[model samples]
Structure formats: C-alpha cells, structure tokens
Target: MDKTFTYQELQKYNGKDGNPAYVSYKGTVYDVTESDLWKNGRHQNLHDAGDDMSLLIDQAPHGVEVFERELVKEVGKLV
Candidate 1:
C-alpha cells in the first residue's frame, strides 16, 4: 500500500483545533478531530475512537483525524 500521511503532517492535523485529516480504514470514514481525538496524534484503540465506534477499523495504520462538518469545535487548547 502507498503511504498517505507523515509524522509532520499528522502532527499539524491532529493535536490542533483545525482541519482534521481524513483517514480511510476498512472503506469507512471516521469523524476524528481535535475535539474528540488528539489534534496531531495517532491513536489506535477503541478508547480514542469515541465509544469503540468501529467506524474506523482496518489493517491501515491508525486513521488520520479528518475535519468533519458535524464535528465542529472552537480553536482553543486541547481539552
């Protein structure tokens, strides 16, 4: 498989209250953002996945948090 996200890019996307990166896993789109998951960090677990949503399950390296429309939040410190 081709590499999609990088450490630097992932950091910029996660761990920040901005545009969340979209990570395609198991042919499903997850609404990961700084609001719920860490802004620029990679979390591979049922905990960080917002109630084991399973919306992002696959062999792919931890999905990159993407900016979801419904997942809106203020640009501030990481709660």
Candidate 2:
C-alpha cells in the first residue's frame, strides 16, 4: 500500500541516526536517508529532510535531474 504522511509526521524521520530521512518534492515523499549527500538528514548543509522542497528546487544549482541522478526513491506522498 502507498504510504501517506502529514507534514508533522514526516518531520520525525529527519535523517538522524536510526531515523529514516524523508523529504517531499512536488507532493511526493522520497527516502533520502541512504544518500551520502543527505547524511545526517542534511542536503549540502542547506536543506534538511521532513519538509517540502518544491520551492527550494529553484535555488538549487541543479534541477530535478538531481533526483534522477541521485537514485532517490519515492516512499510515500505528503498529505
């Protein structure tokens, strides 16, 4: 079954030790905890997990291509 998480619920998985870092982009939640770039739940030390990053994408040096290239997998949907 597909999982659906609220903003508050998603915040709990903030990439901390033993926590599953999850970030939302375009309404989709992705498990970024496994990526080295997201080690400790931080992406480039600029952004963290547990929040929607749709607007932030524009500020990124790269674009949506990072998602495909980094091999991040969607884990759920933000509700």
Candidate 3:
C-alpha cells in the first residue's frame, strides 16, 4: 500500500513509546519517537524506524498535499 506523511504529522509521535505506527515485517512496532533523524525537521541520519514511517505515510513535497492528505488513512490522526 502507498503511504506518506508530513513533518507536522510526524512530530506528534514518540519512539517506542508503548505505541507503534506500523507493524513491522518482523511483527514489531516501530516507535517513531525512537528515531533521531526525525528531530527538529531534519533527517540527517537513517534509522530502522524510518521504514515504519514509510508504512504509515509517504513523504513528498508540500505541493503534493493532495496526495499526502490520505497517506495515513486510519493509522494515527487523520490527515
């Protein structure tokens, strides 16, 4: 399934904070808050949890708002 997300939507999460955005291939929940790359709107580094973020939403330029609006769907808050 295709999915996407925005920086704002990404912020409302915490790493492995006893919640998960997506069920991993290994049957694990990736805590968004655990990823350091998501800090301060800058993804300077790659982390394992990033893959989970992809399952929840696909990131695109702001102009792609039309597409991004439905990325998360029922997961987390509705876009």
Task: Output the number of the lDDT-best candidate.
Answer: 2
Superposition error at 29 for model 1 (Å): 1.6
lDDT (10s digit) by residue, model 1, range 4-74: 43334333543334456433333233435534444443454323322222354444354434334457432
TM-scores for all candidates: the values are 0.27, 0.90, 0.22
Summed backbone clashes in each candidate are: 9, 0, 8
Residues 23-68, candidate 3: write the lDDT tens digits: 1222222333333334532334433332434443344333323223
lDDT of 3 at 74: 32
Per-residue lDDT over 1-60 for candidate 2, one digit per residue giving the tens place of the 0 to 100 score = 199999999999898878988888888888887788888889898998887899999999
Candidate whose TM-score is highest: 2
Model 2 RMSD in Å is: 1.4
The 10-residue segment with the lowest total lDDT in model 2: 64-73
What TM-score does candidate 2 get on C-alpha atoms? 0.90
Error of 3 at 31 (Å): 6.8
Candidates 2 and 3: which is better by lDDT?
Answer: 2
The residue ranges of model 2 lying beyond 4 angstroms of the native Cα positions read none
Q: Which ranges in model 3 have alpha carbons more than 4 Å from their true place? A: 21-79
